[model samples]
Target: MKNTKVYASYRYPSQVISHAVWLYHRFTLSFKDIEELLAARGIIVSYETVRNWCLKFGN
Candidate 1:
């Protein structure tokens, strides 16, 4: 069986992080833009955190 990695230490769920990363790359949005988008959805995350997610997950 293939092992699925879990985001055990992350404060946010995998869906939130993946969605933020997808928004960053798919829409060519800035980290701050993604931050605001998430904030609008009631998910308060920092721009720096979004930037980090892009760096870590982006190609």
Candidate 2:
């Protein structure tokens, strides 16, 4: 229940959001770079969304 709330109201899965946040903090990549990385894997997320995710989920 508590865990679900962490990912509530998001279109993408928890795994995707967590991965994006991880990539952002775990490396020197920018939002666009992470966006492109996900895009390469057919994720199709934008940099702005990446930024939001980082803000919301990143430590």
Candidate 3:
């Protein structure tokens, strides 16, 4: 089976996005928390941007 989903050009790797989403759901943290945690790893993400990914293309 083939799946179809559109994505943004944030250039993040799938694993990173998955981890972000997992934390977002598992810990019940806000997008800002997720963004900051990822940022400390030198990912340079914004809360609004992360929220959009969560709403749209997060896995």
lDDT by residue for model 2 (1-59), tens: 23867898999988898889999999999999999999999999999999999997777
What TM-score would you give candidate 3 relative to the actual structure?
Answer: 0.72
> Better model by lDDT, 1 or 2?
2
RMSDs, each prediction? 2.9, 2.0, 3.5
- lDDT per residue for candidate 1 within 1-59, as digits (tens), equals 12215555779888888889899889978889999999999999999999987888678
User: lDDT for every model?
Assistant: 0.85, 0.91, 0.74
The order of the candidates by TM-score, greatest first, is 2, 1, 3
Q: For model 1, where is the 10-residue window of minimal lDDT?
A: 1-10
Candidate 2 colliding pairs, count: 0
Question: Model 3, 1-59: lDDT tens per residue?
Answer: 12222434547766677678778878989999998899899898888877877877555
Each candidate structure's count of clashing pairs:
0, 0, 0
Better of 1 and 3 by lDDT: 1
RMSD of 1: 2.9
Better of 1 and 3 by TM-score: 1
Measured against the true structure, the TM-scores of the candidates, in listed sequence, are: 0.85, 0.90, 0.72
Q: On TM-score, who's better, 1 or 2?
A: 2
